[model samples]
Target: MRITTKKLVLCALMTAIVFLITFTPFLQIPSPMTQGYYNIGDAAIMIAAILLGRKVGFIAGGIGSLLADVVTGYYIYAPATLIVKGIEGYIIGAIANKKNGVPSRLRQAVAVTAGGLEMVLGYFIYQATVIRMINPTLGMASIIADIPGNLIQGAISAVLALVFLTVLYRTNTVKNLLR
Candidate 1:
Protein backbone atom coordinates (compact mmCIF):
# COMPACT_ATOMS: atom_id res chain seq x y z
CA MET A 1 0.00 0.00 0.00
CA ARG A 2 1.06 3.58 -0.65
CA ILE A 3 2.26 5.58 2.31
CA THR A 4 -0.74 7.49 3.59
CA THR A 5 -0.95 11.19 4.43
CA LYS A 6 -1.83 10.44 8.04
CA LYS A 7 1.33 8.43 8.49
CA LEU A 8 3.39 11.24 7.05
CA VAL A 9 1.82 13.78 9.39
CA LEU A 10 2.32 11.63 12.45
CA CYS A 11 5.86 10.82 11.43
CA ALA A 12 6.61 14.52 11.01
CA LEU A 13 5.20 15.28 14.43
CA MET A 14 7.03 12.43 16.06
CA THR A 15 10.24 13.56 14.40
CA ALA A 16 9.68 17.04 15.75
CA ILE A 17 9.04 15.64 19.20
CA VAL A 18 12.22 13.63 18.89
CA PHE A 19 14.12 16.81 18.18
CA LEU A 20 12.43 18.64 21.05
CA ILE A 21 12.89 15.98 23.70
CA THR A 22 16.41 15.26 22.62
CA PHE A 23 17.15 18.62 24.09
CA THR A 24 14.50 19.13 26.82
CA PRO A 25 14.20 15.55 28.10
CA PHE A 26 10.82 14.81 29.65
CA LEU A 27 13.33 12.68 31.67
CA GLN A 28 17.05 13.30 32.16
CA ILE A 29 20.02 12.72 34.42
CA PRO A 30 22.95 14.95 35.20
CA SER A 31 26.68 14.38 35.20
CA PRO A 32 29.78 16.55 35.46
CA MET A 33 30.45 16.24 31.76
CA THR A 34 28.35 15.94 28.60
CA GLN A 35 28.61 12.14 28.60
CA GLY A 36 26.67 11.95 31.85
CA TYR A 37 23.43 13.41 30.50
CA TYR A 38 20.81 11.00 29.20
CA ASN A 39 17.82 11.75 27.01
CA ILE A 40 14.70 10.06 25.59
CA GLY A 41 15.62 10.72 21.98
CA ASP A 42 16.40 7.08 21.52
CA ALA A 43 12.91 6.19 22.64
CA ALA A 44 11.72 8.59 20.03
CA ILE A 45 13.72 6.58 17.58
CA MET A 46 11.99 3.41 18.68
CA ILE A 47 8.59 5.03 18.49
CA ALA A 48 9.19 6.27 14.96
CA ALA A 49 10.32 2.86 13.88
CA ILE A 50 7.35 1.08 15.41
CA LEU A 51 4.72 3.48 14.17
CA LEU A 52 6.00 4.45 10.74
CA GLY A 53 8.06 1.43 9.69
CA ARG A 54 11.70 1.37 8.53
CA LYS A 55 11.89 4.02 5.82
CA VAL A 56 10.12 6.70 7.77
CA GLY A 57 11.88 5.56 10.90
CA PHE A 58 15.27 5.90 9.25
CA ILE A 59 14.58 9.40 8.01
CA ALA A 60 13.14 10.57 11.29
CA GLY A 61 15.83 8.93 13.36
CA GLY A 62 18.69 10.33 11.31
CA ILE A 63 17.37 13.84 11.10
CA GLY A 64 16.17 13.95 14.69
CA SER A 65 19.43 12.62 16.10
CA LEU A 66 21.60 14.73 13.85
CA LEU A 67 19.67 17.79 14.86
CA ALA A 68 19.98 16.86 18.51
CA ASP A 69 23.69 16.41 18.20
CA VAL A 70 24.12 19.73 16.47
CA VAL A 71 21.97 21.55 18.99
CA THR A 72 23.52 19.90 22.04
CA GLY A 73 27.11 20.88 21.20
CA TYR A 74 27.83 17.35 20.09
CA TYR A 75 28.64 18.18 16.50
CA ILE A 76 31.72 15.99 16.58
CA TYR A 77 29.60 12.92 17.02
CA ALA A 78 26.84 14.08 14.70
CA PRO A 79 27.70 12.08 11.62
CA ALA A 80 28.11 8.76 13.36
CA THR A 81 25.12 9.46 15.55
CA LEU A 82 22.91 9.95 12.56
CA ILE A 83 23.90 6.66 10.96
CA VAL A 84 23.62 4.69 14.18
CA LYS A 85 20.29 6.21 15.13
CA GLY A 86 18.99 5.63 11.64
CA ILE A 87 19.98 2.00 11.76
CA GLU A 88 18.56 1.58 15.23
CA GLY A 89 15.27 3.10 14.14
CA TYR A 90 15.09 1.14 10.93
CA ILE A 91 15.84 -2.22 12.45
CA ILE A 92 13.40 -1.78 15.29
CA GLY A 93 10.74 -0.42 12.96
CA ALA A 94 11.20 -3.34 10.61
CA ILE A 95 10.88 -5.86 13.40
CA ALA A 96 7.93 -4.17 15.01
CA ASN A 97 6.04 -4.08 11.75
CA LYS A 98 5.15 -7.59 10.66
CA LYS A 99 2.80 -8.86 7.99
CA ASN A 100 1.62 -11.69 10.17
CA GLY A 101 -0.86 -11.09 12.97
CA VAL A 102 1.64 -10.80 15.76
CA PRO A 103 0.21 -9.48 19.00
CA SER A 104 1.14 -6.00 20.16
CA ARG A 105 2.72 -7.38 23.32
CA LEU A 106 5.09 -9.56 21.34
CA ARG A 107 5.96 -6.80 18.90
CA GLN A 108 6.66 -4.43 21.77
CA ALA A 109 8.98 -6.94 23.34
CA VAL A 110 10.67 -7.32 20.02
CA ALA A 111 11.05 -3.56 19.71
CA VAL A 112 12.71 -3.39 23.09
CA THR A 113 15.08 -6.19 22.26
CA ALA A 114 15.88 -4.63 18.93
CA GLY A 115 16.50 -1.25 20.50
CA GLY A 116 19.04 -2.64 22.95
CA LEU A 117 20.64 -4.80 20.31
CA GLU A 118 21.05 -1.81 18.03
CA MET A 119 23.08 -0.03 20.66
CA VAL A 120 25.18 -3.11 21.14
CA LEU A 121 25.60 -3.84 17.47
CA GLY A 122 26.07 -0.29 16.28
CA TYR A 123 28.71 0.41 18.88
CA PHE A 124 30.64 -2.68 17.96
CA ILE A 125 30.47 -2.18 14.24
CA TYR A 126 31.38 1.49 14.30
CA GLN A 127 34.14 0.98 16.81
CA ALA A 128 35.74 -2.09 15.35
CA THR A 129 35.20 -1.65 11.65
CA VAL A 130 34.53 1.96 10.77
CA ILE A 131 36.02 4.31 13.36
CA ARG A 132 38.05 3.89 16.54
CA MET A 133 39.06 7.40 17.42
CA ILE A 134 35.85 8.15 19.30
CA ASN A 135 36.28 5.18 21.61
CA PRO A 136 38.93 2.62 21.00
CA THR A 137 36.91 0.27 23.13
CA LEU A 138 33.86 1.11 21.09
CA GLY A 139 34.00 -2.51 19.95
CA MET A 140 32.68 -3.99 23.19
CA ALA A 141 33.17 -1.39 25.86
CA SER A 142 30.57 0.86 24.31
CA ILE A 143 28.03 -1.92 24.43
CA ILE A 144 28.87 -2.66 28.05
CA ALA A 145 28.49 0.95 29.06
CA ASP A 146 25.31 1.39 27.07
CA ILE A 147 23.53 -1.76 28.31
CA PRO A 148 21.99 -0.40 31.49
CA GLY A 149 21.00 2.91 29.96
CA ASN A 150 19.78 1.27 26.79
CA LEU A 151 17.69 -1.21 28.75
CA ILE A 152 16.20 1.54 30.84
CA GLN A 153 15.45 3.64 27.78
CA GLY A 154 14.17 0.65 25.85
CA ALA A 155 11.72 -0.43 28.54
CA ILE A 156 10.52 3.08 29.16
CA SER A 157 10.02 3.63 25.45
CA ALA A 158 8.04 0.41 25.15
CA VAL A 159 5.68 1.42 27.93
CA LEU A 160 5.28 4.85 26.41
CA ALA A 161 4.58 3.33 23.03
CA LEU A 162 1.84 1.18 24.50
CA VAL A 163 0.18 4.15 26.10
CA PHE A 164 0.55 6.46 23.11
CA LEU A 165 -0.40 3.87 20.53
CA THR A 166 -3.44 2.84 22.51
CA VAL A 167 -4.60 6.42 22.61
CA LEU A 168 -4.10 6.85 18.90
CA TYR A 169 -5.89 3.62 18.14
CA ARG A 170 -8.83 4.66 20.27
CA THR A 171 -9.02 8.00 18.50
CA ASN A 172 -8.81 6.32 15.11
CA THR A 173 -5.81 8.50 14.44
CA VAL A 174 -3.60 5.47 14.02
CA LYS A 175 -4.26 1.77 13.71
CA ASN A 176 -3.31 -0.50 16.51
CA LEU A 177 -0.64 -0.70 13.87
CA LEU A 178 1.54 -1.74 16.69
CA ARG A 179 -0.57 -4.85 17.11
Candidate 2:
Protein backbone atom coordinates (compact mmCIF):
# COMPACT_ATOMS: atom_id res chain seq x y z
CA MET A 1 0.00 0.00 0.00
CA ARG A 2 1.12 3.54 -0.75
CA ILE A 3 2.01 5.46 2.38
CA THR A 4 0.23 8.81 2.50
CA THR A 5 0.95 11.53 5.05
CA LYS A 6 -2.47 11.21 6.63
CA LYS A 7 -2.20 7.44 7.07
CA LEU A 8 1.30 7.76 8.48
CA VAL A 9 0.28 10.41 10.95
CA LEU A 10 -2.80 8.55 12.04
CA CYS A 11 -0.81 5.35 12.52
CA ALA A 12 1.73 7.11 14.64
CA LEU A 13 -0.95 8.82 16.68
CA MET A 14 -2.79 5.56 17.25
CA THR A 15 0.42 3.81 18.23
CA ALA A 16 1.17 6.54 20.74
CA ILE A 17 -2.33 6.39 22.16
CA VAL A 18 -2.16 2.62 22.49
CA PHE A 19 1.20 2.80 24.21
CA LEU A 20 0.10 5.54 26.58
CA ILE A 21 -3.09 3.79 27.55
CA THR A 22 -1.36 0.46 27.91
CA PHE A 23 1.28 2.00 30.16
CA THR A 24 -1.17 3.89 32.36
CA PRO A 25 -1.64 2.59 35.90
CA PHE A 26 -5.23 3.71 36.34
CA LEU A 27 -6.62 1.33 33.73
CA GLN A 28 -4.45 -1.62 34.68
CA ILE A 29 -5.42 -4.62 36.70
CA PRO A 30 -2.43 -6.58 37.89
CA SER A 31 -2.25 -10.15 36.62
CA PRO A 32 -0.44 -12.59 38.83
CA MET A 33 0.02 -15.22 36.14
CA THR A 34 1.94 -13.20 33.56
CA GLN A 35 3.15 -10.51 35.95
CA GLY A 36 1.89 -8.09 33.34
CA TYR A 37 -1.24 -6.10 33.96
CA TYR A 38 -4.47 -6.35 32.01
CA ASN A 39 -5.33 -3.00 30.41
CA ILE A 40 -7.83 -1.14 28.33
CA GLY A 41 -5.30 -0.59 25.58
CA ASP A 42 -7.54 -2.88 23.57
CA ALA A 43 -10.00 0.00 23.40
CA ALA A 44 -7.54 1.95 21.33
CA ILE A 45 -6.70 -1.18 19.36
CA MET A 46 -10.33 -1.68 18.46
CA ILE A 47 -10.70 1.93 17.41
CA ALA A 48 -7.61 1.76 15.28
CA ALA A 49 -8.78 -1.46 13.65
CA ILE A 50 -12.19 -0.07 12.83
CA LEU A 51 -10.92 3.23 11.47
CA LEU A 52 -7.49 2.48 10.04
CA GLY A 53 -7.77 -0.97 8.45
CA ARG A 54 -5.83 -4.19 9.15
CA LYS A 55 -2.25 -3.36 8.30
CA VAL A 56 -2.23 -0.11 10.23
CA GLY A 57 -4.18 -1.63 13.09
CA PHE A 58 -1.82 -4.60 13.34
CA ILE A 59 1.25 -2.40 13.34
CA ALA A 60 -0.20 0.07 15.81
CA GLY A 61 -1.59 -2.53 18.17
CA GLY A 62 1.38 -4.88 18.03
CA ILE A 63 4.21 -2.39 18.23
CA GLY A 64 2.38 -0.20 20.71
CA SER A 65 1.70 -3.11 23.03
CA LEU A 66 5.18 -4.53 22.59
CA LEU A 67 6.70 -1.20 23.56
CA ALA A 68 4.51 -1.06 26.64
CA ASP A 69 5.54 -4.57 27.64
CA VAL A 70 9.23 -3.82 27.25
CA VAL A 71 9.07 -0.54 29.15
CA THR A 72 7.04 -2.11 31.94
CA GLY A 73 9.60 -4.92 32.46
CA TYR A 74 7.34 -7.60 31.08
CA TYR A 75 9.99 -8.45 28.56
CA ILE A 76 9.13 -12.13 28.35
CA TYR A 77 5.62 -11.25 27.22
CA ALA A 78 6.59 -8.73 24.57
CA PRO A 79 6.74 -11.21 21.73
CA ALA A 80 3.49 -12.86 22.67
CA THR A 81 1.81 -9.51 23.12
CA LEU A 82 2.90 -8.43 19.67
CA ILE A 83 1.48 -11.50 18.01
CA VAL A 84 -1.71 -11.66 20.02
CA LYS A 85 -2.54 -7.97 19.77
CA GLY A 86 -1.67 -7.87 16.11
CA ILE A 87 -3.97 -10.77 15.38
CA GLU A 88 -6.71 -9.21 17.46
CA GLY A 89 -6.41 -5.96 15.57
CA TYR A 90 -6.31 -7.75 12.23
CA ILE A 91 -9.41 -9.75 13.05
CA ILE A 92 -11.35 -6.63 14.03
CA GLY A 93 -10.24 -4.65 11.02
CA ALA A 94 -10.95 -7.44 8.58
CA ILE A 95 -14.43 -8.03 9.89
CA ALA A 96 -15.31 -4.36 10.31
CA ASN A 97 -14.13 -3.51 6.83
CA LYS A 98 -16.21 -6.13 5.07
CA LYS A 99 -18.71 -3.51 3.92
CA ASN A 100 -17.98 -0.32 1.99
CA GLY A 101 -16.85 1.58 5.05
CA VAL A 102 -17.41 0.93 8.73
CA PRO A 103 -19.63 -2.06 9.36
CA SER A 104 -23.09 -2.22 10.88
CA ARG A 105 -23.56 -2.56 14.66
CA LEU A 106 -24.18 -6.28 14.42
CA ARG A 107 -21.08 -6.76 12.33
CA GLN A 108 -19.03 -4.58 14.68
CA ALA A 109 -20.25 -6.63 17.61
CA VAL A 110 -19.23 -9.83 15.88
CA ALA A 111 -15.83 -8.41 15.10
CA VAL A 112 -15.19 -7.28 18.62
CA THR A 113 -16.36 -10.53 20.11
CA ALA A 114 -14.11 -12.58 17.84
CA GLY A 115 -11.19 -10.26 18.44
CA GLY A 116 -11.75 -10.32 22.19
CA LEU A 117 -11.79 -14.08 22.13
CA GLU A 118 -8.46 -14.03 20.36
CA MET A 119 -7.01 -11.79 23.05
CA VAL A 120 -8.30 -13.94 25.88
CA LEU A 121 -7.23 -17.25 24.38
CA GLY A 122 -3.94 -15.98 23.11
CA TYR A 123 -2.88 -14.78 26.54
CA PHE A 124 -4.09 -17.93 28.15
CA ILE A 125 -1.95 -20.06 25.86
CA TYR A 126 1.06 -17.85 26.47
CA GLN A 127 0.65 -18.17 30.20
CA ALA A 128 0.06 -21.88 29.98
CA THR A 129 2.91 -22.79 27.69
CA VAL A 130 5.63 -20.15 27.82
CA ILE A 131 5.51 -18.70 31.32
CA ARG A 132 5.21 -21.94 33.21
CA MET A 133 7.45 -23.98 31.02
CA ILE A 134 8.85 -26.00 33.87
CA ASN A 135 5.65 -27.21 35.40
CA PRO A 136 2.90 -27.85 32.92
CA THR A 137 0.51 -28.70 35.75
CA LEU A 138 1.05 -25.35 37.42
CA GLY A 139 0.66 -23.68 34.06
CA MET A 140 -2.68 -25.32 33.60
CA ALA A 141 -3.73 -24.25 37.05
CA SER A 142 -2.69 -20.70 36.43
CA ILE A 143 -4.57 -20.66 33.15
CA ILE A 144 -7.69 -21.81 34.96
CA ALA A 145 -7.24 -19.15 37.61
CA ASP A 146 -6.73 -16.38 35.09
CA ILE A 147 -9.90 -17.19 33.13
CA PRO A 148 -12.23 -15.00 35.16
CA GLY A 149 -10.00 -11.94 35.11
CA ASN A 150 -9.35 -12.22 31.40
CA LEU A 151 -13.05 -12.66 30.66
CA ILE A 152 -13.96 -9.61 32.65
CA GLN A 153 -11.26 -7.47 31.08
CA GLY A 154 -12.23 -8.59 27.59
CA ALA A 155 -15.91 -7.88 28.21
CA ILE A 156 -15.20 -4.43 29.62
CA SER A 157 -12.91 -3.51 26.75
CA ALA A 158 -15.40 -4.73 24.15
CA VAL A 159 -18.24 -2.73 25.70
CA LEU A 160 -16.17 0.44 25.88
CA ALA A 161 -14.92 0.04 22.30
CA LEU A 162 -18.39 -0.62 20.90
CA VAL A 163 -19.86 2.35 22.73
CA PHE A 164 -17.09 4.60 21.48
CA LEU A 165 -17.51 3.29 17.95
CA THR A 166 -21.24 3.94 18.10
CA VAL A 167 -20.72 7.51 19.22
CA LEU A 168 -18.12 8.10 16.55
CA TYR A 169 -20.43 6.70 13.87
CA ARG A 170 -23.39 8.77 15.07
CA THR A 171 -21.24 11.89 14.88
CA ASN A 172 -20.07 10.93 11.38
CA THR A 173 -16.49 10.79 12.58
CA VAL A 174 -16.01 7.40 10.91
CA LYS A 175 -17.72 8.52 7.71
CA ASN A 176 -15.67 11.69 7.56
CA LEU A 177 -12.49 9.70 8.08
CA LEU A 178 -13.39 7.23 5.38
CA ARG A 179 -14.01 10.05 2.89
Candidate 3:
Protein backbone atom coordinates (compact mmCIF):
# COMPACT_ATOMS: atom_id res chain seq x y z
CA MET A 1 0.00 0.00 0.00
CA ARG A 2 1.16 3.49 -0.81
CA ILE A 3 1.91 5.64 2.17
CA THR A 4 -0.02 8.88 2.49
CA THR A 5 0.56 12.05 4.47
CA LYS A 6 -2.63 11.42 6.41
CA LYS A 7 -1.52 7.96 7.41
CA LEU A 8 1.85 9.23 8.54
CA VAL A 9 0.27 11.94 10.67
CA LEU A 10 -2.19 9.52 12.19
CA CYS A 11 0.59 7.09 13.01
CA ALA A 12 2.55 9.82 14.74
CA LEU A 13 -0.53 10.94 16.62
CA MET A 14 -1.29 7.44 17.78
CA THR A 15 2.28 6.92 18.92
CA ALA A 16 2.07 10.09 20.99
CA ILE A 17 -1.30 9.06 22.36
CA VAL A 18 0.09 5.70 23.46
CA PHE A 19 3.05 7.33 25.13
CA LEU A 20 0.97 9.96 26.88
CA ILE A 21 -1.55 7.43 28.13
CA THR A 22 1.21 5.26 29.54
CA PHE A 23 3.45 7.95 30.94
CA THR A 24 0.84 10.07 32.65
CA PRO A 25 1.36 9.82 36.39
CA PHE A 26 -2.31 9.34 37.22
CA LEU A 27 -2.73 6.56 34.65
CA GLN A 28 0.00 4.26 35.98
CA ILE A 29 -0.57 1.76 38.71
CA PRO A 30 2.71 0.65 40.21
CA SER A 31 3.06 -3.08 40.42
CA PRO A 32 4.11 -4.30 43.84
CA MET A 33 5.52 -7.44 42.27
CA THR A 34 7.78 -5.95 39.65
CA GLN A 35 9.48 -2.84 38.32
CA GLY A 36 6.75 -2.45 35.73
CA TYR A 37 3.56 -0.43 36.02
CA TYR A 38 0.18 -1.21 34.56
CA ASN A 39 -1.43 1.29 32.25
CA ILE A 40 -4.24 1.42 29.72
CA GLY A 41 -1.77 2.22 26.95
CA ASP A 42 -2.33 -1.21 25.49
CA ALA A 43 -5.87 -0.07 24.71
CA ALA A 44 -4.48 2.68 22.52
CA ILE A 45 -2.15 0.20 20.89
CA MET A 46 -5.00 -2.12 20.02
CA ILE A 47 -7.09 0.76 18.72
CA ALA A 48 -4.24 1.91 16.51
CA ALA A 49 -3.92 -1.58 15.06
CA ILE A 50 -7.61 -1.98 14.48
CA LEU A 51 -7.95 1.44 12.87
CA LEU A 52 -4.67 1.95 11.05
CA GLY A 53 -3.41 -1.61 10.34
CA ARG A 54 -0.39 -3.70 11.39
CA LYS A 55 2.50 -1.45 10.37
CA VAL A 56 1.21 1.54 12.31
CA GLY A 57 0.29 -0.72 15.16
CA PHE A 58 3.82 -2.09 15.38
CA ILE A 59 5.52 1.25 15.08
CA ALA A 60 3.24 3.11 17.44
CA GLY A 61 3.02 0.41 20.05
CA GLY A 62 6.73 -0.39 20.09
CA ILE A 63 8.12 3.11 20.01
CA GLY A 64 5.40 4.50 22.25
CA SER A 65 5.88 1.89 24.95
CA LEU A 66 9.63 2.13 24.63
CA LEU A 67 9.44 5.87 25.25
CA ALA A 68 7.27 5.34 28.30
CA ASP A 69 9.74 2.82 29.71
CA VAL A 70 12.64 5.17 29.26
CA VAL A 71 10.85 8.11 30.78
CA THR A 72 9.70 6.00 33.71
CA GLY A 73 13.30 4.85 34.35
CA TYR A 74 12.51 1.23 33.55
CA TYR A 75 15.39 1.18 31.11
CA ILE A 76 16.08 -2.51 31.49
CA TYR A 77 12.68 -3.44 30.11
CA ALA A 78 12.76 -0.99 27.20
CA PRO A 79 14.10 -3.45 24.66
CA ALA A 80 11.73 -6.18 25.76
CA THR A 81 8.77 -3.81 25.72
CA LEU A 82 9.62 -2.75 22.20
CA ILE A 83 9.60 -6.26 20.90
CA VAL A 84 6.67 -7.50 22.91
CA LYS A 85 4.30 -4.60 22.30
CA GLY A 86 5.27 -4.38 18.65
CA ILE A 87 4.37 -8.00 18.12
CA GLU A 88 1.19 -7.56 20.11
CA GLY A 89 0.09 -4.70 17.89
CA TYR A 90 0.97 -6.57 14.71
CA ILE A 91 -0.89 -9.68 15.81
CA ILE A 92 -4.03 -7.71 16.62
CA GLY A 93 -4.04 -5.78 13.36
CA ALA A 94 -3.21 -8.76 11.18
CA ILE A 95 -5.98 -10.91 12.60
CA ALA A 96 -8.58 -8.18 12.92
CA ASN A 97 -8.04 -6.83 9.43
CA LYS A 98 -7.59 -10.11 7.60
CA LYS A 99 -10.84 -9.67 5.66
CA ASN A 100 -11.68 -6.82 3.30
CA GLY A 101 -14.74 -5.63 5.20
CA VAL A 102 -14.88 -4.68 8.85
CA PRO A 103 -14.13 -7.47 11.26
CA SER A 104 -16.97 -9.13 13.14
CA ARG A 105 -17.18 -8.90 16.92
CA LEU A 106 -15.92 -12.47 17.27
CA ARG A 107 -12.95 -11.72 15.06
CA GLN A 108 -12.12 -8.63 17.11
CA ALA A 109 -12.40 -10.61 20.32
CA VAL A 110 -10.11 -13.33 19.04
CA ALA A 111 -7.59 -10.79 17.83
CA VAL A 112 -7.40 -8.95 21.16
CA THR A 113 -7.29 -12.21 23.15
CA ALA A 114 -4.41 -13.53 21.08
CA GLY A 115 -2.59 -10.23 21.38
CA GLY A 116 -3.14 -10.08 25.15
CA LEU A 117 -1.84 -13.62 25.56
CA GLU A 118 1.23 -12.71 23.58
CA MET A 119 1.85 -9.71 25.82
CA VAL A 120 1.53 -11.79 28.96
CA LEU A 121 3.68 -14.66 27.69
CA GLY A 122 6.30 -12.39 26.15
CA TYR A 123 6.85 -10.46 29.38
CA PHE A 124 6.89 -13.68 31.38
CA ILE A 125 9.65 -15.12 29.23
CA TYR A 126 11.62 -11.89 29.32
CA GLN A 127 11.31 -11.43 33.07
CA ALA A 128 11.96 -15.06 33.82
CA THR A 129 15.09 -15.31 31.70
CA VAL A 130 16.73 -12.00 30.91
CA ILE A 131 15.56 -10.18 33.98
CA ARG A 132 16.48 -13.06 36.21
CA MET A 133 19.97 -13.14 34.75
CA ILE A 134 20.40 -9.40 35.19
CA ASN A 135 19.32 -9.45 38.80
CA PRO A 136 20.05 -12.84 40.18
CA THR A 137 18.48 -11.81 43.46
CA LEU A 138 15.07 -12.05 41.82
CA GLY A 139 14.22 -15.72 41.96
CA MET A 140 11.83 -17.58 39.69
CA ALA A 141 9.04 -17.00 42.18
CA SER A 142 9.61 -13.27 42.16
CA ILE A 143 9.73 -13.21 38.40
CA ILE A 144 6.47 -15.09 38.15
CA ALA A 145 4.78 -12.67 40.50
CA ASP A 146 4.07 -10.16 37.77
CA ILE A 147 1.85 -12.45 35.73
CA PRO A 148 -1.45 -11.59 37.38
CA GLY A 149 -0.91 -7.87 37.02
CA ASN A 150 0.01 -8.27 33.40
CA LEU A 151 -3.00 -10.45 32.78
CA ILE A 152 -5.28 -7.93 34.43
CA GLN A 153 -3.75 -5.11 32.45
CA GLY A 154 -4.28 -7.04 29.25
CA ALA A 155 -7.85 -7.91 30.11
CA ILE A 156 -8.77 -4.35 31.00
CA SER A 157 -7.10 -3.03 27.91
CA ALA A 158 -8.90 -5.54 25.73
CA VAL A 159 -12.25 -4.49 27.11
CA LEU A 160 -11.48 -0.81 26.70
CA ALA A 161 -10.29 -1.34 23.13
CA LEU A 162 -13.40 -3.30 22.23
CA VAL A 163 -15.64 -0.65 23.69
CA PHE A 164 -13.76 2.10 21.93
CA LEU A 165 -13.88 0.23 18.64
CA THR A 166 -17.58 -0.35 19.00
CA VAL A 167 -18.17 3.34 19.51
CA LEU A 168 -15.69 4.50 16.86
CA TYR A 169 -17.06 2.13 14.25
CA ARG A 170 -20.41 3.81 14.50
CA THR A 171 -19.03 7.24 13.68
CA ASN A 172 -18.77 8.46 10.11
CA THR A 173 -15.32 9.89 10.77
CA VAL A 174 -13.93 6.51 11.74
CA LYS A 175 -15.63 4.85 8.81
CA ASN A 176 -13.97 7.26 6.46
CA LEU A 177 -10.63 6.74 8.14
CA LEU A 178 -10.94 3.01 7.76
CA ARG A 179 -11.65 3.34 4.08
Return the top candidate by lDDT: 3
After TM-score superposition, the amount by which residue 17's alpha carbon in candidate 1 deviates from its true location, in angstroms, is: 1.6
TM-score of 1: 0.73
lDDT at residue 15 of model 3 (Cα atoms): 96
Candidate 2 regions exceeding 4 Å error are 134-138
- lDDT of residue 86 for candidate 3: 95
Q: Write the per-residue lDDT of candidate 1 for residues 18-115, one digit (tens) a residue.
A: 78877775465542222434566777777677767787778788888788878878675578778877887888778888565433867766775776
Report the C-alpha lDDT of model 2 over 40-69, residue by residue, as the tens digit: 999899889888888877988899999999
| Candidate 3 local lDDT, residue 103 | 85
Candidate 1 regions exceeding 4 Å error are 1-8, 30-36, 98-103, 124-143, 175-179
Query: 11 in model 2: Cα distance from truth in Å?
Result: 1.0
> What digit string (tens of lDDT, one per residue) describes model 3 on residues 28-146?
99876667788989999999998888899999999999999999998998999999999999999998994576788998899899999999999999989898888888777866888
Q: lDDT per model, in order?
A: 0.67, 0.85, 0.90
Q: What TM-score does each of the candidates earn?
A: 0.73, 0.92, 0.96
Better of 1 and 2 by lDDT: 2
Q: Each model's number of backbone clashes?
A: 0, 0, 0
Kindly provide the TM-score of model 3 when superposed on the true structure, using C-alpha atoms: 0.96
lDDT of 1 at 161: 64
Candidates in order: C-alpha RMSD to true structure: 4.1, 1.8, 1.2
